[model samples]
Target: MDCGPGDEGDGSSPVTTPTRTSSTPGRPSPPAEPSTAGRSSAAGRPFIAGQSSTAGRPFTEGQSSTAGRPSAPARLLASPAGVHAHARIAARADPHGRTVLPVLDGEGPLALRRTRATGPAAHVTLVGAMSGPLGGDSLAIDADVGAGARLSVGSAAATIALPGQDGAAARYDVRLTVADGAELRWLPEQLISVRGSALRVTTRADVAEGGRLVLREEQVLGRTGEEPGLLHSRLTVRYAGRTLLDQELTCGPGAPAGWDGPAVLAGHRAVGQLVVVRPEFAYESPESAVLGESAALTPLAGPAALITALAPDALRLRHILDDALSRLM
Candidate 1:
């Protein structure tokens, strides 16, 4: 099977369409309201005065100090084709942060939602979403792609904020399970952590026999005019039970400063990862070389068929994807 752009439904840009399943229930039920007594302020004022109170400590009076913060959770909207796949997408605020409200809506051809703030360290999980950005109040995504499903995930835009100074560092954990003959394509937007911001991201995937998977992750530092920011990134990818890729990049004033060298980033402002895995199909020499040059691609030397690429721009990365898919076709 070609399994490329044209081979799929329409050739227009891909979008995520979420549908509910028993495995992935509807949006979380709204939390119960606090009692009248619990709504009073510490200064003896009524609940109205307590609405904007900041002097109280965290998690006091059955109300969290971090309530009503900004959080962007995952949403799986319906696709244009209306192909019903058993998919699940859910999120839980981290123990340290506040619980956020995850909005769920279907907009034409895409499903959309934002995570209302819980507190700091609130984390959301996507059991399943086709493709789009995952934003928290802190601005990041923690995603998982299950077995036997074709999932192509991405972000709405580039994230430039970080933790502490601006907020907590954005983090993502993507786990993929590709069953026999299943496929997954994850293409999230680039992540740009500002100078004072911090980020920690990781992705892992499990591929069964005859299964296929494709993944892309990009990280950038500094805005067009802002000074270069700090970035701490670690990526790990697993196939079956074996580790296929492990890399760590820490860029900051205090960290080592040799990334400009030829072996490292070579002063490129952006970096990315594109991976494709299949058991039967293989890349030809010409196609392999083209992919290698476009994204500085690399192939895993093992029983599994996996290709990885690192790029400096989204356009180039997309071009590489097109070429790779064309070759596969």
Candidate 2:
């Protein structure tokens, strides 16, 4: 049977007789063959109509079709070493209606840009821009600092979040390598993990002999409203194969019942940590207050400086260190 385009086998068309040519006087003419190229043709019908070509065999759609469906999430790998300066990482919805830029910075003066969003849950995007906010749907950052290169990291506004039942989370892993005689100053804005939210950050720095690393991390919790605590954070710092600092803070339900003890938080709400490692660096004793006030300072037994603060709030702790950092610079 001859089939044309746009025709289905409903048996509505009239049958047409086939023309016959005799090859030999005694042999009957062979049946005419059907065209196999068109969808209406029998040979192409099975494939185009989504039917099995082989009898009793089922047809299976592979990745090309299944790709449209949302499946389980796949694991993804991110390397800060591969990113250039002034790059965006990720952005997401927040209770406060503001955008969150996880990581953003570069390797020169004005190496980092800071900005704030207007509304609650605003869409944040990161693009490679020369000026203005570096936008991204997720995180943003610069992972590379050439040998002997200098860079400074900072954020523009206090990241805020609204109250919500379901918690939010973010993770940052930064690896910095400073060659001999090089210096790196990393001063990122405070991270605000509002009540009921959780955040985890890990930073590793590899510095050669004679290299200098100045680093600071500030976190605030429950900025918008009153809550037991604003953040639960864990931080680890290492230098030249020696562990410089290992600290963890868990507020609220699982917080240490004796956190008010002299050895613990001493009933303070906000906390900050700063570590500076250099071959020949000098820091006053824990008795020397960081903010000229009667603040608490804990000095490790080795060549690193570790200071902890219990401020009225996370914001206070952030500013205390910000002022201290300006002096160090």
Candidate 3:
């Protein structure tokens, strides 16, 4: 909750919390011996990254690629392309059993770090070393879910979009791929579009047959007691070579946003949405359904639903989102 500039809240704990797990190759968990100091224990658990069915037994020390030394934390990067942060996680089926294994875990700014394991799911949180998306800033996340893997992911704090040093617009792009029979739940924190700031979130996901995906997106046009800024968002989802969702929203032209006029936000300060795609999803989404005046649930094509919550302040908006989620959760 106390997310500072360039720093994130402690999401590694609550110890049972949000985000999700990931994987990649590492030194196998070594046998107890003087030669294998600092080796992580594989005897604890084998999570595919998100949440897997109970069919496969968990992986043991004798069957792990990352049982040895742990992966390093993410670093900050800045280049001509812009200040960019990258995190990649890939999961695979363990040859030893029905369990899934993590083969890669990496990140830059808005770094993704895994905490402890819980059941068939791996916990992960995104932490930042500094304030970002200062116009032209790009954050790209790539996740791959093997044929039977599962993963959950979230951010430790809200993304504070600030004006760029050279007045360029900020960008955050996410790319997710869920293979056959895989699952991924991506629920990051709200994004704060501050006054004079320009921010955008471009997300693209590809889900293979029999896969499932749950994703949440929240945005705040302005912090408490401040004017709104500019926000642009895009979402694209496809499965089995069929496009399920393709949409975009733009608020204001540039720096000083037009929150009062005829924008979709309707002078509101906040908005939130959730999307779910499962193998069993067959209901036709309706155009829109109001939720007690605090929110509206829109059924999109396929097995996806979008909830939009609008309020004069952040608190009310969040409460509305929570109420809407409780029904679906």
Candidate 4:
């Protein structure tokens, strides 16, 4: 079965969009409201002690800098723009049956580092070099596990998407391949969608016959007490050339009506899913059942199982997913 998801959007061009104030690490602070004591009001009459008539303008034309150099806003405008980056990882088994990482390449904002593994599997962690996946940025990560090898990949922190100068939608793509008899575990941190940002994510995994996979994905709608931006995600998994799962989800503006309604998110701020594929499932399939209030575990048509859950925050979501993973595995 090839159940591909529908297109989300082109996201090829930049369009001006409104952004909100944010204090996320690596995000720039919005320029302060400029003083408008001498400007004319809309009615051609200016009053008020410390207010500006220019409703939305950041600063007036004749405003002079504190020094000979440009103002802070000007300096911010000249800062480096978003980046296009790709990171790659390859794990192979040695003659002694130990997993080894022959390729761990990091680029731009997507820095890949080899970390200490708890078991035979080689571990790799993602480290962000700078703030990104901002609007207009394109990021991708490719990982491959050779036959008979075991590998695990994780991230150091949550990814925060912020609006860029161009206002374009940012994109992050992940591709994974596991050869026969190999195993892979992809456990990344949550992704937080800040207000006024737009992000699109695609994750595709191909597992050969006898290969095993454990993957997790989590999304946080927004920060504490704040409205979310736009977030679209698609997850596709193929086992031995057959599509096991292909799902798409969208939230915030432009999503399907009532996405956050009772039938969907139900006012939840965090959502996540876990997929586990192993050869053992072919003989003894797991039973479908609900795990608590907002989570379910069901066996797929093939030798695989899926666990989906929702929660009010990232902590609760992680706890739910973790509990489900323990039960399933």
Candidate 5:
């Protein structure tokens, strides 16, 4: 089924159509007072005032498509035949050191939402209104952290990227720019890759000498009783003009034979990676951070720490990663 997800629109107004069930339900229930719900969080840090946007709505809730949303000057998508969409966000810090989200825009099925601030970090989540990704679908998130600022990014839940009938693959690309003396914690929970789905993720991070990065990526090949899809993920990290980590992993139904080996994922169905760009973060050898015989962590060859592992499911992967992150600076 080639579902184009209708015409794409920038994240400038409210969502009017009903949501499809194929996409995960990531939105919390409507708050009592919608105006003050943007700054709502269930953890440390005083709520610094914000609002939650829906898969169709912009950064403001209860507002019409043209009534009360921030004007996005740059919008794309000039056709209705393709499924490609784009979402861009810019973040900075106030004089008090609190992170602030300035730009959040999306066009197509993919949406961007800014949730509450958690522990001095601005929280943002991506919501897909369609059943999932179709062929040629693209989503990009760009974050610019000012000097001395801190940003934390999280997904409400897992994203399922399903393949379309056009023989084309879906893509999700993220670019992060950490300024001097800044930090960013990207903790995306998981991505469920369905069978026959060709999904590729390119994550590029440019960190300053004094900047810090604690990034994590969790991947599940397929759900219970399902065959694995095709997943090709690449990570490129550079600090002060030097490449710290540049690696790529490809597997699933379309992978070449002899790709299965003990040296690569073994027999695990899920995988996770936790990368710390700065040496200041405390971390032990990947061999020591073990969940069980089903999961193992191995550090990528680099000057900085690039820890990657495989597990049986998302919960176990998260457990191992959470412990690893707790030990970081």
Candidate 6:
């Protein structure tokens, strides 16, 4: 599949046809193959500003923000205090069941923009108003979907984590809440960890019994040929007050031994995970199976499914995740 620096792939490739291992007694049929054409090849494409951290950089003064957006104030961008930013989104349903955003608040480097939607679901795009998540930075995003509402969240570009003057690790937190009868899709771009940077990210989802969710996360250990710095990530999800999935990953210089060995990343640069939660999954869940060579799909204890994959590059990683999502949904 072709995923240009600017395009995130949304189609499938036949090479990733899953190899099933087991099935449950009462499970729905797997999703049919998506008929969309495969994307073009992303090989040898140069990294743009948002797709990478070191774009056009010599760490000199007067550098511009990615995508022509205005950079943050000089004091904030260069301050030794680091950045503290938060963005919040609250979506509710109208009497006629149309989704609406009553609260869209963004601060510091995290900017939220409402975009035109193709359906009833309210869509939001996260814009990186400034270069960030540098070491010592603290950022968080909170989203709430009320009952019967549908919301889809995406980012304008990939996030690049860079080194900071303080030598402290950057922190990012995501909190998502899905009310009963509501649906949410959190599909952001990849996060690239640059050399000399340290970053830690956590994502938690609280889903009501009848709520539905589809979340995707992708991490690129380092830009093209560079060595990664330090990265740690954790994900937790609860459905109806019960744990559905909880996992953690660490990589780079300070990670546990052999993290890049065969059993783990196996030298892959891009790693990703996808989770889908639906009430119907309680009655019918996908069977444990291997999708392609680098990805796996398994049914969770509740009405959820998980997909984990690794790839040589962000393009391929998104292909594997997108294929798994198509199969699950």
| Candidate closest to the true structure, highest lDDT | 6
Clashing pairs in 5: 11-106, 15-56, 38-50, 38-51
Candidate 2 lDDT: 0.40
Candidate 5, residues 187-271, lDDT tens digits: the string is 7768888887888899998888778888888888888768877888998988876787887888787776644577787667788
Residues 198-317, model 4: lDDT tens digits: 999999999999999999999999889888889999999999999999999999877889999988898999999999999999999999989899989999989999999999999999
RMSD of 4: 15.4
Candidate 5 minimal-lDDT segment of 10 residues: 1-10
Expressed as tens digits, the lDDT of each residue in 1-329 for candidate 6 is 01212122113221221111121112122222223122211231111112212221211111111223433333345544566666778888878778777676655556565654677788776755455577788999999999999999987668888887658999999999999999999999999999998999999999999999999999998899999989999999999999999999999998999999998999999999999999998788889999888889999989999999999999999999988888887
Positional deviation of 311 in candidate 6, in angstroms? 0.7
Instruction: Give the 10-residue window scoring lowest on summed lDDT in candidate 3.
Output: 15-24
TM-score of each: 0.53, 0.51, 0.70, 0.76, 0.74, 0.77
lDDT of 2 by residue, 1-329 (tens): 12111112212321222111121122111122222111122222211112222221111111111233332111011321111222322222223433333333222111222222232221111111111111111223434333443444444334332222223343434556655655566656565555544444456666666666777776655554555432445666555666667777766444667654566666565667777766664344333455655254455554556656557677678777766655443
Q: Cα deviation of 83 in candidate 6 (Å)?
A: 0.5
Where does candidate 2 have its weakest 10-residue lDDT segment? 128-137
**In each prediction, how many residue pairs overlap at the backbone (N, C-alpha, C within less than 3 A)?**
31, 22, 20, 0, 4, 1
Native-to-model Cα distance after best TM-score fit, residue 171 in candidate 1, in Å: 3.1
State how far residue 327 of model 5 sits from its true place (Å): 2.1
| After superposition, candidate 5 runs with Cα above 4 Å error | 1-13, 18-81, 279-303
Worst 10 residues of 6 by lDDT: 17-26
lDDT of 3 by residue, 1-329 (tens): 11211112122211111111122112122122222111112342211222222221111111122234332221221254345555566655454423333533333344444543454554455543234566776777787877876677766557777776566788888888988888888888788888777888899989887888887888778778777568888988888768888878777555245545655666777777777777765654445668887688776667667776778776787788777767665
Ranked candidates (TM-score, high to low): 6, 4, 5, 3, 1, 2
Candidate no. 1 TM-score: 0.53
Off by over 4 Å in 3: 1-81, 95-104, 253-263, 283-289
